[model samples]
Target: MTESFPTVPLDGAPGMPLIGFGTWLMSGSECYEAVRTALDAGYRHLDTAAIYRNEPEVGRALRDSGVDRDEVFVTTKLPPPRADQADQVLAGSLDALGVDAVDLWLVHWPPGGARPDVWERFVAAREAGRARAIGVSNYSLEQVDELTGATGVTPQVNQVSWAPPLYDPAVEAGHRDRGVVLEGYSPFKNTDLGDPVLREVADAHGVTPAQVVLRWHVEHGVVVIPKSATPERIRANLAIDGFSLSDDEVARIDGLAEV
Candidate 1:
């Protein structure tokens, strides 16, 4: 059975679903089905990007799910190459997704355009009501500061690669001090779920290792989007609300970092 998912508040809009379903490599009918399955499994947040080239499929799934558009929180990204044409790029995404406005729009990566210039365009999108909230992905602390310092507009969220193996308290503190919500992607890429420590925690909670790791992110207040096309994993990923990780357990995973 699917579990009830919760939400985390953003700076300028309604709260975002804490656990989002990610569609990175998925496309065509597979992407549509994955999204449909995710929504049916109780996932209210869906994350996609222009680079994925799956917006239309995702939009179709959303329409077929019988779920009200307002009930689901959708996030799509702006690639760096389109930074100069931010307005057109976002419009194209909206058209592809068949949505009037996305709940949150993000800059997919940092290398395409000048950080300040790109961020300014993103801010313009929010101002134009094309996106309810705007943020950045794959940005470092310095770049995040540069955007705010230059444009006087801070990004509401920073989506980056974060996992037990690469978690850094200092960098995370920087995000918190800047009032940026740390939304983590590729959460399962950096760690070995089969590690005895993680397995032991999973055993204790009678859940999977992935659930243990996701719960750890929850306890730290980080938004996690775990991608999976399988229905069983989709349901399992959102079933994290029923358990709580001990402070000691969280510290153990924190201390297990290789970097």
Candidate 2:
């Protein structure tokens, strides 16, 4: 069921699912249970961060869920402040997750917004096999280019706060042109689900506006990680694969962007 989910091919790793389960503010049992439910709901991709301080819970859920580690796409991040201790911090993350390496590792944010030095450490992790792929979060296109210029290694992904209201075709094009996969977070928190356009589209498809928003991301090839603790919603988020939006529907949602 997971193998057929829409995915974006990565250079040296398994294809990343277009839709994933994001664990940001969640922690403790809440985080673990939510992840278990997500995996059971057919979410093969899971996104967590060191700063989120829930890798242990996420790992526990993964192990307890009985999903083959190789079958699940797991991602974690490095806090910018840990740039000087990248090796140690990553070691800790690996130990906590009980994995030899993460499918993807990201610099949580740019250190001073231009630390190719940190990116270098990320490259080292990948080369050393501690990370299958390397990337950055909360980065601008210029910053992404700066790192690439400095290290000669382009980050495989860039995660940012993305939603229909925050959409920009030029930005998406920039990532595409540079060969960076754009991953979005907070799909619901960042969107106004009550918007008329979303409602109209949802009504037509017999799905909620939230599902339409998620499907919208996949339509553009942008990876989306929607976080939810509710069991029903966890399953519902992954249900987006059953239907697709028309080009007209996509354009209508794109028009919701303040950009």
**What is the alpha-carbon lDDT for the whole of candidate 2?**
0.92
Clashes of each: 0, 0
Cα-based lDDT for every prediction: 0.88, 0.92
Decoy 1 TM-score against native: 0.96
**Worst lDDT window (10 residues) for model 2?**
1-10
Tens-place lDDT digits, model 1, residues 170-201: 97899999999999998888779998999999
Candidate 1 minimal-lDDT segment of 10 residues: 1-10
By TM-score, the best candidate is 2
